[model samples]
Target: MSIDFLKKYFFGDVQSSSDVSSVAFQQSALRILLALTLCIFLVSEVHFLFTAGDYSFLAINSVYLAALIGLLYLSRRYEKATAILFLFTLVTASILLLTLSNEFHAEKYALISLYSLPLITRLLFTFKASIVAMVANLYPFYLITNNSWMGSAEFLDSANLLTSADALAGASIAPSFYFQMLTFVTLNIGLPLAVSRIIQTLESHAIKMKDLNQKLNSHYAMYEEFFENTGTPSLLCDQRGKVLKANQLCRHLLTGGIKKSLAHSNITDWLTPAGENSRFAWQSDMAECTLKSDSQTHINIRRASLTEHGHLVIHLENTTELKAIQQELESTQETNSRLAHFDVLTRLPNHRHFCQQVNQRLAEHDKHVTGAMFIIRISQFKLLNKQYGKDNANKVILSFAKTLTHKLSDQAVVGRLRGVKFSCFIPLSQTYLIQKNLSELIKSILPKQITVEGNKLNMEYQVGIAYYHTDGKNAEALLERCEMALEYSNSVERFSFYNNNLENKLIEEHTLGLSLSSAIKNKHITIWLQPQVNASGDICSFEALARWQHNGQYIPPPQFISIAENLGLLPLLAENLVRALVETLTDWQKEHIHTPIAFNLAGQELMNDGFFAFLMALVTDKPWLKDRLELEITETSPVMTHPLVHKRLRSLSQYGYSIAIDDFGTGQASLGQLVDIPANILKIDRRFVFPLPHDQRHVDIVKSTIQLAKSLDMKVIAEGIETKEQATLLIAMGCNTLQGYYYGKPSPMTDWTSHSNAKAKTLRMVY
Candidate 1:
């Protein structure tokens, strides 16, 4: 190690100094290079001093140069070595300076500045290494100064020994070199340290700005996505009311792929013309507008201005669906209103609306001359619908309206007030002409068959003309008198004008109709019993005939029945009859009247889905009632019009209720239907009885009907039996049950049961 160090330090050619410290090496190298350069400049200037033979300065300079070259070589190796090698280099440098007293004294005063290298080591290396370097640099100064080796003559003379006398004698370094050194310390060391801190601060700010830019981009991307995918159209505008951005929906609505950056188009164009003064204008600061487009679809536009971004956001929402829903709701409300005030099928004002219109007309009654009004009704409309169908019946009504329209003037108005019924208004000037025209028109129109669903319908219209005030201007009273006139027309088979005498007749009819409820409740609607004798002339059952009596006048069942069904009072009549028969049977059952009681079922009652169950429940818990209770439904009942009746009747039969088909030969039932129904008994119609015992066509039909019933396992009974001759003829022809005045005139339960005629007595007339 010493040999290499001597060669490296003395010869300035160290090749294997491996363990040198980087800071120590750099510090020593810098000092040595600075010393050598100064010596070179001094030697060049003082060649004459060398001629005077003062060679000590030359020797000292050579030593310093050698030390500097060794320091440079050590510095190269020391930067790669550990702190210990740097410490050794520091100690070795200190020892070398100690041996050369003159060279040490020349640099010994610089030891204080060199001590700062140890402070650099503490900043750049470990504390122990710094302390070692600090002591190594400072101890030489302490030794040279305290031991009196640092005096001016000896110390400066040692540094001067390497310089020629001629270089020192006349040449000068000038005072600026020291000043330049001071300026170099300030510019290089101080400025570079300050610059490094500034660069670090700028780099940290760059990193923060980069992170903030990333967050802003992320938020902007999210906002773009939300606006584009939302259902409503969205637009963003700048402060000048120019569109800056628009979402996909807004593009489709307003620009049609034109970029939102367009200047001319904006939210103002989307506003309805009617809403030009709307708040969509920036000056108005209004944010919303609702209007209809050219396509009649409704749209709602909403806007919000952003003061910070200096832009406005517009949202367009189509409200067409909401408007459609509102229209549908309004239509439903209108239908309910119509139902409350008008008839459903006719589309004409109902009784309710008619009364209101009449009252209104009465309020303005003094404004015009009195006019005559006509309440016209087609008397056979129900029978027509029953024979044909409702489709034909509706055509008949429409035909009547057409005829009345053609006959009356434009000033006159006709309205359908009830089913198969119409009312007409006319001025008194043309009353006679209107009445004559209406009469002739009805005569011409009523006879023609109306074709409906490929079926011909025959019907007749009955007109009841009532002059205003004379027939009572009040709606109810006038309607009553008009009905009386219609009743007269139907009886006479012609148009009937209301006269003073018809009021009494109308009073009588009203009295009869009003007493009907009481009569039904009291069982005064007589259950006239008629015996049905079997083929062997044995009584099998008795049919109950409903007869009405008002003020001692007997009214037929057919006359009251049609009215009862129309008034919605058929159910009450049915309930009363069922109760009366059940009450009568309670006594008869005690007397051992173990016979089936057959009653005629109304067409209206059979059509009702609830009527059968109601009757069944009324007879519930009376199991004895089942065998004797027979439901006689006519073939003319509107069963074919509503097919569900058969299913409902089949359900009743499944529960052990017996149902019978009455008037089989005269009705509209087809031959195919006669076999498929659930009835247990088939009654020969009264029309068959009308041509019986003589008419071959009637006999053939009756024979076929009987065969048809027998094939279906249904018992056949002949109705309208009058004479013993007809009975004997029917019995001989295998007709089983007979009912008419021949067995007994339709008598009440008490009279029929108590009379001697209740027995199987022979008839007065012989067969």
Candidate 2:
């Protein structure tokens, strides 16, 4: 075999990268001893064959050689098993040598190896194994050496464990025996224990050294990687702030992209006066500093870390973008604040900001303080809008606002409350000062004329003033009180002060408006029929009237009608009235009553899209309704007077509705205005009919109205005939129909529909 192969077989490559030793020294020691013992036994067996003619000893040695070769073949793969078997092989061979020494009566030198068994066991294995080998060797040695054993003297005398001749003679045999016993104990127990302890200490120290070196290498690699490529702008510096090493970010930040090396430059030199105030320093806890460049670059020290070598490493962040963002945020906040408080068109403080300013001014004084808050309205603004267009009106208002701003004191809080209305808070803190502002100051400040589209328009205004203490307690209350007073002002008076009576009037109107809206929505307003009969008093038709019984008190028609018209709720009221009329006519038609029912329509109702569409849809769906449903327009509304106003009524006339001009004599209709009125019937108003048959002035007026209706080929119905005489006089005056309490007063439709025949018979006596 090659020397390398032989060496590998005897001792495999046992060095390992791991901390644990790859090859146990005990296994190696055991393998070497087994090889040596096998060779010696082979030689001894050959001697036995040649000298003693024992051929069987050679066969026995062949088995031992085979065992040695087989164990060596598996030793590298199974180290623990091979090592234990090899160790025991040596023990068994030693035992065999003793046996041969006793069997052949050979010298004591054959027992030499047995004495070294304890020391070999200690070197190859643990102390427990050494103790076992020591005991095993002792038992066999006693058997071969004791005096009482058969032929023990031949084995003891001839076998010299000393290996040197004449060391002990026959006379010194006992001393020689003592000497051999001493050698056995020392080799088996004493020498093995001493070497085992020394080996253990050296192995432990070697392990600690290896761990320290590995930790040092790991720390060095981590630092090297972090310092070179970390994203943060970082610098490695000494205590004096000299740049030792810098990351790529830091190199670009201070050294112009690393083109100029910063090996010896001080980082502190870049600091402006503000940044110079916070010098970088090392501390046990994480520290920070601020710095600025010469070019107004903002730099912030995020952290400063101390390295293992006691050097400082500072990480910086650029905050210039964040500073710009902060400034932009502040600008946006300021703009939003102004938008929240000021008017978009005029750039003036709105109601909310005006209230705040007023309260602020009032808070500067005590409870005794009193001033004036005026609710100023631009006079006839809506009229101006119709005359010159809304765009031109807006320009006029803008000019007025600019004039007020120039003339009013800075301390005054003047704000536009809503369209065409402005509020001015004059915090004079005295009654005389408020009067001065009112009598001469306001009139002189506002110009008498403001031009619109190069045309001079007269400037006029009305003011409603509310003073503190007597009027209200705060700005909100004061402004509300001023509005209450403004409701009482008219064009003649031009101004009014808040009083308790005005507040009561405002509350009454407010409550009535609410109740009127509810009544229209819920159909609570009852439609009453005032029977209009022919001259014979037979019920032919009915004039429908609206009535309301709210809170067990009757509300007059005139009171609620005016309220409905003013509140822009006339369409809703008219809708309810028409529904009542249609329902009554349908029920009467079922009873075979062919009388037509007429309900009044405001001039504005025909123009309202929702109400007009509803009327058209109803008529279209029930074509029979057009013959029964009659339309009455009050003459005072200018529907028959204005040419465009009667056009819608004429369309209705063509649709089979008998249009009537109601309240005829009272409408101020001239002959020219009466020429084009599309009327199928003319009803003389109650005012002219009330004094009929007695008052000569009304007699002539009613006669003339009836003659005018006759000439126009229209039927005449005299309204409000309360007495039998008035009804008779109206019937004699060419009146075809007469309606009044003389025949039947206004009652709910149920009363007339249930007893129409009986009521008509009773009303016939009046004629």
lDDT leader = 2
Candidate models: Cα lDDT each: 0.63, 0.74
Quick one: best TM-score, which candidate?
Answer: 2
lDDT of 1 by residue, 1-767 (tens): 99877445433542453223334444444444434544653573366355664365456545555654554455544643433343344444444445453454534423433544554454335445555654554444445434344345444456553244343333343342354344434432444345445444654675676577678888999988998998888777765556777788877665445554444565555545335555435434343344322446456655655657666676777677888999898979989899888767666677778767765666665745566666877767778779768876777777666666676776565567877788866656554545676566446534455556676655556778776666677666767677778777755666887888887866665676777766765666667777777766566777887778777778878878866765666777887777778877775677666777887776577666567668768557687887777888777756543567676667767667788877775567556445456788888888888777789888888888777877878888888888787888788777767777777666676664555334422321111
Off by over 4 Å in 2: 1-277, 280-322, 325-349, 352-372, 379-394, 405-413, 425-445, 459-462, 467-470, 473-475, 489-497, 512-524, 533-538, 561-589, 599-744, 754-767
Pairs with backbone N, CA or C atoms under 3 Å apart (clashes), candidate 2: 107-159, 108-159
Residue 729, model 1: lDDT of 77
The number of clashing residue pairs in each candidate reads 17, 2
* Model 2 vs. true fold: TM: 0.56
How well does each candidate superpose onto the true structure, as a TM-score?
0.44, 0.56
Residue 663, candidate 1: alpha-carbon lDDT: 75
Q: Which regions of candidate 1 deviate over 4 angstroms?
A: 1-222, 226-234, 250-255, 258-303, 306-311, 314-368, 372-406, 414-423, 429-459, 462-767
